[model samples]
Target chain A: MTKSKLSQQLAVDNLKIGSHVYSSRLIVGTGKYPSEDIASKAINSSGAELVTLAIKRFSQQDAISNILEVIGEKKLLPNTAGTLNAKEALRSAQLSRELFKTNLIKLEIITSSENLDPNMPETIKAAEMMVKDNFEVYVYCDRDLNNCLKLEDLGCVAIMPLGSSIGSGRGFDDLDDLILLRNKIEQILIVDAGIGVPSEAARVMELGYDAVLVNSAIAYANEPILMASAFKNGVKSGRKTFLAGRMSRSKSSIASSPTQFLK
Target chain B: MSRIKIQLNGTVEQIESANLEIILNTFAPKDRPFAVEINGEIVPSAKFSDYSIQENDKIEIISAVGGG
Candidate 1:
């Protein structure tokens, strides 16, 4: 009935990344699912338009489940996971482009196995190479402002600043830095990693991130299907609330009821 | 069989025919999507049939694995 409600209902702006635009802002991962059936149902429920995959080696005799069949129309984001250097990451990117038939790459060269944080220097070099090679790089770098700016300058389509380390489920607590980065950079801003719950995903989206990439939170859940649905709602709610425009916070508490009445 | 040895995904194997296609057919289904590298060089799918594998070559076949 109100203008606010009307806008909330119509908060369906298409998310643009590079030359491509998508309707769903929640991007899910195709990893860690206990089974293909669960993976299929979870992603189907999540309302995700894209999913990330790690390119790995499987002997032809090994019968690993085909991820493409489960994703079903969702765009695939093949990442350079498990690679520790720019050279290896480059090769993985090339292979991913060939296999996924998409230019999009989540360029990640982790510094270590303990925490899958992007090694800044390696990531930057790989991003530069990938961009030059005509691949749309969605870089997974730290939330450092200058670093993000450099990545944008390198012609990456999107910059993913971690909420925390990958798969840690640490969530984005001190999101002020990310907010600052988002304000300064003109490129697509997506929160990737360290998100452990639906509320965390919603919070990041509410903070004005273009999208969020989620995996462990859902895939490792006791009930992945239910968690996936929760994430769908979370992203929707957060996007809606963001578009509706949240009321400015006050330094002091503002009473909704009559404080003078003392009831 | 006049076999030569090549390393496939970290395992050494003996093969009579030293071709990428033959090795690939032994491990992967033709219908699936995958990429191949011989001694760290990407061998385009178009050239799989012609690319010859040599003794002690490191062959890597990377396919789609789920991840975020």
Candidate 2:
């Protein structure tokens, strides 16, 4: 039997987000895992084409070797975590580029520790510098439509708007803002951080977000593999629903039985 | 012979070595980057040349990986 036209269209149109091409627009993080093995399994199950990692001190006693080995040829995205200024972010991005051997950098500049709120000014500045330095910048910013547009103007390949505070597990609080940002920004719109459950991810994708990046939720789950699978399904379902398009909502329900047809 | 034990890829192993760099050179060549953990603390890559290993010392090495 021939497939539906919607499915055929979706199959033909490839979703392009920045430099990365994804059949499934879900990005996962590699942190807070019970074990490296579980993290690897979870990531593979999630079907994420891109992943995030922080550049920090690598210890002699560290157990990340097996994890690295497991990752093999997958894309490694190094983030500039805890950088409060543009200079620090730039330096971190540069170092990560050398260390991870990838041009993709998740530009994160924090202003306060309470909420891990990103400093928009610094983030924009750092993004500009990284772009000029020939790096693909994914700026993690608050759910501010204006700021998102500004970041897009700064030449960021992707604008990662937070669903909530980083690692808060609160999920998407500003759905309106995210929707507006999605409508305004031409670049890739990714919801990064604060996604507590698969529903949150589904909600973002349903709202037409290009992708979602999650870390703590999967990493800290009781069963990382199960949670990862959940996320993977949620993202796929959401993207499918969005592309399928929904019927227009009306306050009054349309009766299935037509009054004019009644004898 | 003094037996120096360190965690290799998260597994404990013992070797006989007097110099730290020699042992590391024997295991991980300088060309590659690996995070070395001694006991529970991580030894910075920059200090690998200077850091010495003693008998029964636990070491762990982790490398940057790509996934997800």
Candidate 3:
């Protein structure tokens, strides 16, 4: 009989944002699924405690089942995905709070339609208003360190930097800045968007990111449920590796075998 | 029955009554969770029954959809 050292070494680690605590560091989005059944199954397999949903117009004559019915008891983090400016984002946030009855919001104010880049000024404006309105805002910004620092100063509960352009799946576009940003920011940092595989999730976690929000990689996969499970394991492994404290990188390779062995 | 015209979700619609709750119930199930706004102000669910809908009011009924 053997005991796993990794399990023994790690304590109970939970991701906390504002007053809410989540057990899973992987946050899943409920978008671009083939069906609600598949989305539900995939989300279940991922073991995500927090899920992101976007608020949109409710059609009058639509007979389709509501997405909320499948979400059940999982905590909802509503995002203002389509808003272009501060006013629209604020209204969307208010409506989301009223509908979901939660103050947790993912503030996204996209500036360009072609690239879908976030409007930094508009996002900051919306974030400040949301915070003043007593909402726990989680901002989605670019990798620019100065903008991220400004966002943190505005009282957001979490800062989500795009892994690449949204849904581009190019992995991390700027790894160096990501590492530096990790050292600077003290709030909960979750790398959101543009992550295509489990290994990338692992890589982000290995860099000591608190969490990762993935949607397209899992939702659009050939087998979403299986992919979801893979990401869950990836996140866990990365977190454990981070906790273990990785060996320092050396310019020259040191031989593993002892040089003076059996002399 | 007299009808009043108001904008519902960006479209002009004629309704039989001016009650907010009745209009909401007619379009959506009571069990479904959603939020209603009239001319840019959010109306709480509890107030739906007590609130009155005005003519030409731009009403937007919103709910959660899949997103990341």
The number of the candidate with the highest DockQ is 3
By TM-score, rank the candidates, best first.
3, 1, 2
> Can you give the TM-score per candidate against the true fold?
0.92, 0.78, 0.94
Give me the candidate number with maximum TM-score: 3
lDDT per residue as tens, model 2, A153-211: 88898899988888889987778888888888888889998899999999888888888
Better of 1 and 2 by lDDT: 1
State the displacement of the C-alpha of residue A100, model 1, in Å, after optimal TM-score superposition.
1.6
Error of 2 at A117 (Å): 1.4
For every candidate, C-alpha RMSD to the true structure in Å: 2.8, 7.2, 2.8
Candidates 1 and 2 compared: the better one by DockQ is 1
Q: Candidate 1, which segments miss by more than 4 Å at Cα?
A: A1-12, A252-263
What DockQ, between 0 and 1, does each candidate earn? 0.74, 0.11, 0.83
Cα misplacement distance, residue A40 of candidate 1 (Å): 0.7
